[model samples]
Target: MSFLGFQLRWNSVLLGALVTAAVLNDVPPSYEALVVLAPVIWADRTTLTWVRIRRR
Candidate 1:
């Protein structure tokens, strides 16, 4: 798969895992969990930009 596809897939997986964990624990996701998501969000955006530029 392409870099964009890989990043999107993993980002979704991470988000799903976070939501599932919160549900299992009977609590909202914590700040730490959101912190972990921040990097994934950044990487996804970076990868998207790189891919778009490379395709040009």
Candidate 2:
């Protein structure tokens, strides 16, 4: 195993575990909360996407 391969695999495994831990720890989460927040984030993306739609 080369240096790059070892580093990439280590990062992927570590990140996957960290994300799983965070999701598993969040009890009784509000799933619909993201549904409400989705539009807000999309609107906040950038001026380019908006310009393409002629919103501004």
Superposed on all Cα atoms, the candidates' RMSDs to the truth, in angstroms, are: 6.7, 15.3
Mind giving the per-residue lDDT tens digits that candidate 2 earns over 1-56? 11221123343444455557659997543557446545554554222221222333
List model 1 lDDT by residue over 5-53, tens digit each: 3334677677778889899999998898789798886665323333444
lDDT of each: 0.69, 0.45
- Candidate 1 off by > 4 Å: 1-8, 42-56
Cα shift from native, residue 16, model 2 (Å): 0.3
What are the models' TM-scores? 0.49, 0.33
Worst 10 residues of 2 by lDDT: 45-54
The TM-score, computed over Cα atoms with residue i paired to residue i, of candidate 2 is 0.33
> What shift in Å separates residue 51 of candidate 1 from its native position after superposition?
22
Tell me the deviation in Å of residue 21 in model 1.
1.1
Tell me the RMSD of model 1 versus the true structure.
6.7
